[model samples]
Target: MKTQDQAAQGKVALVGAGPGDPELLTLKAVKAIFRADVLLVDDLVNPDILDHARFGARIIHVGKRGGCQSTPQEFIERLMIAEARAGHFVVRLKGGDPFIFGRGGEERAHLLDAGIEVDIINGISSGLAAPSSIGIPLTHRDWSQGAVFVTGHGKTADANPDWDALAKLGMTLVIYMGVARCREIQQALLAGGKPASTPVAVVHAATSGSQAQLITTLGDLPAALTESRLASPSIIVIGDVVRCASQDLFHRLTAEPDRIAG
Candidate 1:
């Protein structure tokens, strides 16, 4: 039981809203929402999650979607600091695992430097959820020995990943925000000796009603994405593990009852 004075003390909670499904939100995240005096939400978070916020909680949209008008990170930090300093419980709600490519580290550093107490609540990252939703396992004893998660978009072109090193690993590669530079990524992987026949799948709007997927070969990834016209907020999965979805075992399990009867 927290006293009113303790409740009013300035603090910040960096909460992960999970991938997209509102039901996937963690119980701890829901509790933080209810306790929040102000919520700084990301652009990718589903609106339904906000329903958990207590009545009269101030909600501020500070989403930063790629290639669109975005709230500056610096500004968002300053605002959070200001709000918390004013004795408000601030919740910085982000989509996916806040620590994974959500810039949660940066925000946490800023708040800590400003003498604000920070709490972190982890959530499911799309990297894991997207592939699982599509029946693609990141690791399988028969196929992939391990898995690697990397961001397709970096702070700068020079910061781009070393695709050659990744190709040598011979493991599942899950790329986040890679749609915009699919061609470049494809070329890099090809140059790094990855086979053209490597299986690739792009999951769009994962875990949402609008969720969709496109499966193709590594060599054809660019063309397939172009033909499908899939947009951002997509995860690109590559490796032999992708073939697991098409295996006879999976097909048999998912086969319709009518088909099985026939």
Candidate 2:
């Protein structure tokens, strides 16, 4: 009934779902979800956020978790292109800010190469949410003048962050995907002249109802995590600004050395 030129010309939207809180989604993200004909969702996106989707919308779960089996990136890109060419509004929903380690850049490049239209809607990043949830200010006049967000793990060994240079930056350090490599990260920072007494905070599932957190010094981080049993999907904040965390959340694990708050 319709010719190729008469069919709808669909576009792709790379929308950030925020850090696990449905309420944290931006107004633009909500509208995009409502308008999408097909949504490719990542594992970290909150399932509840789908309530905004229009009825009869196709939702595809493309789980991508570190150290777990995940949908291939190539397949996702191809699907987006195929769906768009078929006159479907494709929404690629990712957790946290899409540009902040969510692989939005890669997807955008692929879509452009295929001559598909794309739009990006930003959302709150977990790095910002994790520290704020506990009342820890990332930047303080007396504590830290700025902050740096780095990934603890990289796609490849050579892709890993330079912990040595990061240690000497004299700013608040917020680490993503660092829990599995806690000991290695700690040792690298220590070897790079970061003091063993530097304060650290590890927040799990930050901003979610099941959130948990621990506070300790750099030297005790590995042991603290082992005791707390906090795993991936956690944010590690390192610097003096951790001292600014709310007293209500502070529980001293021991009094001998630096205080371990759990």
- Top model by lDDT, which number? 2
Q: Which residue pairs overlap in candidate 2's backbone?
A: none
Task: Please list the C-alpha lDDT of all candidates, in the order they appear.
Answer: 0.88, 0.91
Cα lDDT tens digits for candidate 2, 1-262: 8566436768899999999889999999999999999999999898999999999999999998888999999999999999998889999999999899999999999999887889999989999999999989999999899999999999899999999999999999999999999999999999999999898999998888888898888999999899888888999999999888877554452244454535
Please list the residue runs of candidate 2 whose C-alpha ends up more than 4 Å from where it truly belongs after superposition.
Answer: 1-7, 251-261
Model 2 is weakest, by summed lDDT over 10 consecutive residues, at 250-259
TM-score of 1: 0.91
1-262 per-residue lDDT for model 1 (tens digits): 9777556669999999999999999999999999999999999999999999999999999978888999999999999999998899999999999999999999999999997899999999999999888789999999889999999989998898999999889999999999999999999999999998787878888899888777777887887788778898999999988776645423442352111100
Model 2's lDDT to the true fold?
A: 0.91
Report the lDDT of model 1 for residue 231: 92
